[model samples]
Every structure is written in C-alpha cells, then in structure tokens.
Target chain A: MSRTANGRGGHGRTGGTARRGTGAPEAGETAAELGEFGVIDRLTGERFQPEQTLLGPGDDAAVVAAPDGRVVATVDTLVQGVHFRLDWSAPEQVGRKAVAANLADIGAMGAVPTALLLSLACPGDTSTEVLDGLAAGVWDAAADAGIGVVGGDTVSADTLVVSITALGDLEGRAAVTRSGARPGDVVAVCGQLGWSAAGMAVLRRGFRSPVAMVAAHRTPRPPWRAGPVAARAGATSMIDTSDGLLADLGHVAAASRVHVDLSSRLVPVADKLRDVASALGGDALGWALTGGEDHALVATFPSEDVVPADWVVCGEVRAGTGVTVDADRWGGSGDPGYLHWR
Target chain B: MSRTANGRGGHGRTGGTARRGTGAPEAGETAAELGEFGVIDRLTGERFQPEQTLLGPGDDAAVVAAPDGRVVATVDTLVQGVHFRLDWSAPEQVGRKAVAANLADIGAMGAVPTALLLSLACPGDTSTEVLDGLAAGVWDAAADAGIGVVGGDTVSADTLVVSITALGDLEGRAAVTRSGARPGDVVAVCGQLGWSAAGMAVLRRGFRSPVAMVAAHRTPRPPWRAGPVAARAGATSMIDTSDGLLADLGHVAAASRVHVDLSSRLVPVADKLRDVASALGGDALGWALTGGEDHALVATFPSEDVVPADWVVCGEVRAGTGVTVDADRWGGSGDPGYLHWR
Candidate 1:
C-alpha cells in the first residue's frame, strides 16, 4: 500500500494521486468512506493542465519539462492550528494560503512557477467535501499562477498538514538571490504589505464587519507575474514578505551584508489596516511593518527610478548592519517572525 | 521571510534546504537550541551536488536539470508512531525507510532518480543528533541511488512526519506501467518478500535475537537498478512489492485486464524464514505471499524464459478476472497490506 500507485487493483486503499489532482469527480464522500483509491479516482479525474506539465498525475511520477533545464524548487508546510484555524478559514482558503505561501517563495527567487507537488496529511474522518474544496483551491491557485499540479502523496495523520513543493522556470535570466543586495540599493515592494496580518488580528477579535481584511487573511493573492518582471528589471536582491516587512528585510540585510533604512511613512498600509487597528486598539503600522503571509515581493534595485510604476520605493540600502526604520533601530516587541517552538 | 531563500539575515529563523548535505559542523545542538535558521545552516551548509542539480539549496527554490526534457516525480509521507515507532527504529532507519519507499515507487516507473525534495515536521524538542542521523540517511540513500537533494521545507508539528518528493529521468525509454501485461505473460519477482513483514511481527513479539528480520522491518533496501533494467528487458507490466505479492499482482492483473495465478511453491522464501516462523508459531508462506514493505519488484514478462536470471517466476497471467492461486481464487484473510487509520 505504500507504493500507493496508479489504477492498481487488489490493493484496497492503493491506486491514485488525489492529494490535489491528477480532480476525479466524487461527491460527498469522506476519505475513509470512499477509501484511498476511490478518493484518488475522484480527485484526479479532472485537472487543468498547463503547457509546462509534460506529464500530469496518475502515474508513479509525473514528468515536467523545463526548457532552461533548470527547475527552481522550494517547499512549505502548514499545520492545522498553527497556520490557520478551521473555524476562521474554510478548507479552500487554507489550501490557497498554502499554495500562495510557496508561490511567493518562488517569486522571491524571481522565477516563474511551472509545477507543484502537494502532500496532504489528512485524518481518516475528513469529509470528501473538505477534500474537494482543498483540491479545487489548489487547482485554482495553480491555475491563477499558470502552473499545474504534477504529483503528490496523501496519508493519515493526527492533524491536517499541507506540504507543497513548488517548481519554477528562471527563463534564462539570473535568479535574484537574497545575498545580492549592495550599498546604495533602493528597496521597494509590490503588492499589499499588512492586509493579511491585519486580517488575522481582526479575525482573532471576532469582528466580521471588515470582510476584506478577513478575506485577505484567509486567501492571499500574491502578485505572481511580479517575480520575473523584477528579475528582468534588474532586482539585485529579492524576498517575499512572509515574516513581515522588517523581519524579511532583516534577512535581506543580513544575507547581503548591508544595512537597510526604511521610512515607515513610505510603507503603504493596507486598505483595512487602519480600520482594523483602530477597532482593535492595535498598531496598523506595526502590522504593515511586521505582519507576514501577505506574499508581497520586496526587492532591492540599484536605483529607485528603475522600479516599475506598480512598485513603491520604501527603503535604501547603506554600508552598515541591521535594519533601521526612520533613521533609528526599531526594536519591535515579540519574535521577529513566527517561531514554531518556544 | 516568505521567500525563506538561501542563508539570509533578519529573518531570525529563516533560510535554506538541509536534506543531507551542506553538512554544518554543529555538535550537541538540539532543534530547540539551534532554532530553524541555525539548523538550516548546519544542515544545508554543504550538500553533495549531483550533476542534475543545476542549482542546489541555499536559495528560495532549487534548480534541477532534466536533459531529457521530462522529469518524473512522486512523493511519500511517513508518520511517526504510525508508519514507524521511534522505539522500534533509530532516526537514521526512519529516514532511510522514507527514501526507500519513495524511490521504490519511482523505480516502479522505470526511471532513474535525479533529485529529491524532503520535508521534515518534528517537535521542537528533537535533538540535533536525530536530525543529523536523518539527514545522513537521506543523503546516503540518495547517493546510493545516484541522485542529490535539491530543496525542502522544515516546520514544527505535533508529531514527526517525513515527506519526500523524488524526481527521476527516463533516459529515452517507455515507462513500464501495470496496464501493459498480456494474458500470456509470466509473473516474476526480484528481491525478498516476507522478511520485512515477518520482521514486524517479530519485533511486535519482542523476539530480539532474530535480528535480521527486525532489521528488515526497520530498513528495506529496494532494488533501485532493477527498474530501468526491467524497462530495458521489455517487461510487459511492473509494480513494487509494497502491498504484498498477491495484492500487488492483483493490481497489475486488474489494471491489465487479466487474471494472475500464482504457484505458492515457486515463490522464494528467505533462508531464516522457517526457523522464525516455527519459533513464532506463524506461517512463513503466508507471510511470503501477503507481507508488504519489502520493496521487491514484481513484474510480468512475455514468457518465463525471458525473465532475468536474478528473478524467480511465481505466476502466470491468464484471460480471467481476479487473482487465483493453484487454479483457484485465493481468499486470504486479514488486511492485504498496511492501511493507516483503521
């Protein structure tokens, strides 16, 4: 049963790769009720194939061709309680967040997403409705990014854990690494900064009025095309706003061996950030600076003038260490980013 | 930090892939002590780069080259206390089993392994020694299969979960699938059968002196080379013995629209099986036919004579439905193979 192969008989729970797709159509069936094979057949029955997917699911392994012969790959794991609460986000939203997080990482490398491998650690009692929602969410996200779900694995675990490995194509351009920033570089960002984080705070406070913030927290919409665009436009160093702007930029400053000075005033706040912060008596600017999971791309360019119109210049790289905001070292409270363990 | 790309700063706990290489020289540091980034640096500091790895870890996404313009991928997840118990196997053995299970699936596709992406979900209390052992085992297994670890993700979870995605190269050959077997084909197997299952039973019974079977249950070495070799030999159909000889063959027969009849006397049994069975008062033959996780490759050939010398013929494919033994349908008892969540 470990092989969990394709269209095999005799192995009751064997046969199929429906962790996301390669989506067979089955309705209202729990994974346990349908069995692994039946669920796989239902989940992999219909999948939107992208051009880069030389081979899709329903085999021992799916084949994907990279014309550049270089495939960019990274992975992320999300837990049930730590990453999201089932009460706060629907199954589709959870899956979308998972995909968004990984895709943003690919974007950080300035690579165009091509394929994905999704592993779902589900409990036996999980309803097929949840599975369908998750599969649909993954497919939709990949579709949005112009990629395909190639292969995956599914197993029963104590809690739901979504693990995804994303592959991307560099398109014959040099990848923007985190260690490439130098002095005199202008740090800029495209996409929302703290909407998701603010949304998270709003959700935690049980406020439903600002639906947009809550929606952003549940399903982040990353600027997918911005990756290759920034690369082509000559981004010296790049990263995704996964752990909050300052925390992420801290990584850039550390890796590039330079200091970054950010004007908090220049950091554009999310639409609902001020409202949510005011209602919760929280700092919207703090969320904008340190909130993560927005999947916004932050890059360093030699000159701010070269940055596209869509991106906003917020900081500058200098010959120093650490990250400073408004010409002073901002000693924020709490962990810079979310740490798994205490 | 979302990019979580190569060794970067400010993201206090962000950075890099650490499957087995980038062997960092840190001693006596637990995951709790080292945190995620420190562990990443120590783990991904030095990795053995295979020819296919155009860009190894220490970046947002790794780059693996597929010269054949196609890449084959599959994944598997091993859960602690479910797939294995920490007390029954060492950390290294668990990691090795994880790689072996995934590689065996890739081998079933008749492809050569090129790169791997490994994800680890463990508690904060896990020691660096355990991490080292797991990393070393993954590297050793990948090295044994002539591949490299390109990228992966690490996170904290309630329990230990190892998720591995394996990539392979077909090298200009047709992938031998289970649906190609003809009615007149012969069924053959290369490698051990009941050893691992019997080993599990022995371990559960606390018969420690019979070390080999216990070891087999802990670490299964699948015949990786046999996959491409079988593809070259023109096998009609193929599958790995991950779900027992009869159960796995039943899949092949079902997929190929044929009936497979096995001669129990013809199936190979390990040398120590009789004594182990006698001592444990268990049926060794039954174990030989139904035991799973041995990772032996079972395939259908055009004829018995055409089968490789190392493989033993045990059955024949016939124009019928279902699987039979000695000209009668074999209705074996209990689980066909291991299934999670009863």
Candidate 2:
C-alpha cells in the first residue's frame, strides 16, 4: 500500500502554454512535433547523477546503488486536473510537488532518498515549454534531495499524469514504521501544519493575496530530513502529515493500536495562518488539526527527553483508540480529512 | 530515453465489469464506494511477498533487499486505449502486460528482477472486478518472475493509467549496456519476433480464429531469462525488441557507433505466421524484421559459436553506421516500427 494523499483542490491552468521562460520548450513546439525520442531526450539528456547512480538513463534500465543491502521504495501519482492546475501552479511547481510527495514518504521511513524514476502520460499536443518546466522542477527537487532522475517513461494519454517512483537507502539502520508507537510515547511534529490547506483556502476564494500562503499550496517544502533525525533520536513510530495532521495521526494510531491525545493549546497555530483565517472568517485550529498536504513529519518518542529540540511536543500516546483533542473527540469545521472518491 | 514500445493497436472492452467468477468483485461494487483505503487494502492485503521484500506494504514505503548492493530500476506506463483495451485483453492480461514490460527491460540489462512498485490511476466509477483482475495479473507475473509488488499508489483520474517500476539485481556482474557492440559481434535473437504484431493484425482484421496469435498479443511470454544467459555467454550488447527488431538494433548501432547487417534468409519466420500473412496479404518476413512488442531478447555476441544454443544468429555488427538488411537499407511496408505521438 503506497501512501496516497487524496482530495487535493486543484485550480488554474488549462494547458501547458509557456509563460515565463527559463529553459522552457521553445514556443509552438508540441510533444507530437518533437516526437517521443525527441521529447525523451529533452527530458533526460543532460543531467549529472550521483555516485549512487551506477548506470543512469540511456540504457534499458538504470542501475542504482543500494549500498545498505536494502532499498526503500514508494510511488506517487499527480493528475493534472485533480492534483494541480497549470494556471495556478507552474509546470515546474507541479513537478516539484510530485517528487516531494515520494521523497517525503522515503523520509518517513527514516531512509535517505537515492534515485527517482518518472512515468509521464500526457496529451500529444502538450507544449514543450511545459515539458521543460516540468523536467526542470523534477531535477531541481531531486537535486535538493541529493538524488537524480535515473530512468523514466513517456507516453501519450488523454490527460496529463505524472507518476514518480522514489528509491531510498536505510544506511544499516532499522526502518521506523507507523506500527511501532507505544502507549507511553510522546507525539511531536516538525515543519508547517495547515499552511497548504490555508493556502488552498486562499486560492479557492479567488484571492491570491498573502503570496506565501499561495506559494505553500503550490510547492510544499517538507522537513524530510527531520524524519531521519527523529528516527535516530529513538522515535517509536513516524509518519508524514500528508492527509492532514489528525487524519495522518489517525493512521499511525490505528497501525500502532494506541490512542493519541492532543492538547489544542499545545498545537502550534502560526500567526500568519491565524491572520489569514481571521480575514477569511475561518478557524485556524481546525485547519491545523484537519487540513492536509503540508508534508510535515509527525512522530512518537518514548519520552520528552529523547524528542528532538526542533520537534514540537503537542500530544501523547495513551491507552485508548483513535485521536482526541482536549480529551474529547474533535468536532471541527472540517471532517477528519478529505477522502478520495467520496 | 526509457525505450518506449509504440503503436500497439488496441481493441475491445468499455469498462471493468465482472465477467469472470474467479475472485471477481462483488456484484456492482465500485472503487468510489469502497473509498481509497478500501481499494488499497484489496489491492495489496492478500499477497505473499518474496524474500527480497524485507518489509511489505502498509508502511509509508516498502523495504526490498538488494543483496548485490546494486538495483536495476526501470519504469513503464500503460495507458487505456493506447496499450490495451479492456475488451480485447482482460484486466488480468493488462496487469501482466504492464509488469512484463518492465521485467523485460530488467532482463535486457542482464539482471534478475527483484521487486515492483505499481501506480494505478482510474475513474472512481471503475469496477472492483476490473481492479481484482488487474491485481491478480500483476501478482501472477511477479510470482513468475520470483518477486512481488512491494509498494504502490492509486489515485483518481479520468483515464486509467498503470505505471509500474521494476527493481532488479545484477548479482555482482557488470551490466551489459547498449553501447558495447563491437565491429565483429554476431547479432542473435532468443525469443519470438513479430508474433505480437501478427496477433494485432489478426485482431485488427476482426479475425480471432488463431487463438494462439491473439493470446500472444494479450499476454507476451518474454524470454527474460535469456538475457542473463546471453550475458554469461559474453554478449557484447543487448536490447528488448519492444520497438521492433530493426529499430531496436538501430539504437544499438547508434549507441555503439557500429553497423548491423541482417541476412534476410537467416531471420526466422514461423509457418503459422506465414499462413496468417498469406491470409491477410501481409509480409511475414517484413513483420519479423520490423514488428514490435514481442519482448524478444536481441543481442550481439563476440561470435556465432559464442551465441547460446537457443539463440538464432541472424546478423553481424560492422565498423560503420545504422542497420541494413541483406546489405541494403530496409524497403519494407511499415516504417522502422511505430513512433508514439506521430
């Protein structure tokens, strides 16, 4: 079961028309005109791979180094209309978001991301500018994670779909899973919460003010490294907050068979989010608790002393089931989180 | 470039309705009603993973053992109406085809496939029966390859897309890349050629009399093991005939900066294919030379004697350029294989 984040509210672009130029495909050149091989060459022709890439693209398959004798793997897909709109998010931003989702999963397992494989399905008439931007974004995010796109496939379809597979190495350490939390563990979080949801809210209302919020929605900068840090600090269990804090925490609780008790006051609600919420007549606490797609790292530690300094202790694991706020079930503005196909 | 096999004329099936009784979905159940988690559970819950899957599904990511410290990774995408039609090929057949595509790439690299990651995107209204068949097909192929699907992601999309990533092990041997063919290498093939194209031709003409040809189109039996055998026998270069024999060999010739000359008389053409060609007024030899999607292992060896007993020697590599048939460029019916987005 590869972890999938659902119900992302996509808005904006109708097609891959190149707007801002930075190594984008030349105007008027479509993927069909370039042909499959041409498009593939444009996507993967020039790239510097790490030492972990024993044999990169241009082969039947790429050879990646999995030095620890084990490889951590995950797959994530981003549909054009369902995940992001071209008008709202740049092709590069969409590319970054796609890679970020899988890298965050790798980090949640307390492993170092190694390589990425991309499978892109789009209409034949898709513009080269969009392809270039998407490629740039993918390579940029991969570079940020210290890896590269070793291999990929490109095919034609009715809609644009970007599916990415990420590989990671555990470095001889045990993988921290979601099923290991105990009754006496401490619940902590590192990285932004509710920012992406708030950003989405801002975008949904037809307002683009508060540039930071909209940017967060377009590109989530997950604290991926914090996952390994927590694991090294003896984290009992961990997960990435992709499906909102409460919803994701519920996954950990269900897997670990432990109850999570959250103190609303202890859960940090950023002043910026509060300001945006007040302006929009929204509930900041509800957003923090239930809004998803921030890609934050939430974890459980045996004790407060073992918790990393950067992680904010907001809850505790107890002898019960499900999650609670102020010792009671959460009755908030939103449901636990968005469910796909609902 | 990920070596995409283009131009498979798809036929049949409108949606995923349970036509078969073997582990099919309950009557009229849909993925939307089951929700995302339910769909995931059904897809991954009941599978038995191989020893290479150190940690199976349910976590943020899966851990697969890579005993050789290296993993051969490749990704391939199969789009509805492009690669397969549900009516023409069962959902199980589609799943098998998707996984088989990647496994062939792994084999072409002289590696043994170890694990698979699947990403499925379809409408919420997709039938549970279709999904079940798809999962069954995927697992069956994996079992045959001595591996399992360790991780995957499923999301909602207008068009159904099956994207698979296959990981393989080199077992401490040097990867036989495409750029290693020498001037005196002998070109040999170890699997059926043009069979899939012939099957597609039969289907296109509304004649399915030859069940064997249609079955070949539905589920190709790639000679994946022959890759490592050829490598052990000291193959100089190798590739899968996904994009037809001549086109694929052209890739080798370009990458290795050598010339490949195929002797027309030596190329194998089965009598059944000849009969079918006679009925359809199609050239069997032309199909054998340029038809794609057979997943045949075509490689170059140091000499004809060095080629394995199972392989059929058909050509030789020279110190010049491109691919030539009978000492001249091919003047065949089809373009040197099909081109995607053309």
Best by TM-score: 2
Q: Docking quality tier of candidate 1?
A: medium
lDDT of 2 by residue, A27-97 (tens): 34888998777667666665667778787777788888999999988888899888889988999999999
Per-residue error at A322 for model 1, in Å?
2.9
- Quote each prediction's TM-score: 0.90, 0.93
10 residues in a row with least lDDT, candidate 1 chain B: B7-16
Q: Give the TM-score of candidate 2.
A: 0.93
User: Candidate 2: how large is its RMSD?
Assistant: 7.4
* Clash pairs (backbone) in predicted model 2: A13-A87, A25-A129, A244-A292, B12-B87, B13-B87
Candidate 1 TM-score over all chains jointly: 0.90
- Writing each residue's lDDT as its tens digit, candidate 1 over A60-93 gives 5666776766677778888887787888888888
DockQ of each: 0.50, 0.39
* Interface RMSD over true interface Cα atoms for each candidate: 3.2, 11.0
- In order, candidate lDDTs are 0.76, 0.81
TM-score of chain A of each: 0.92, 0.92
Look at candidate 2 and tell me the lDDT of residue B264.
88
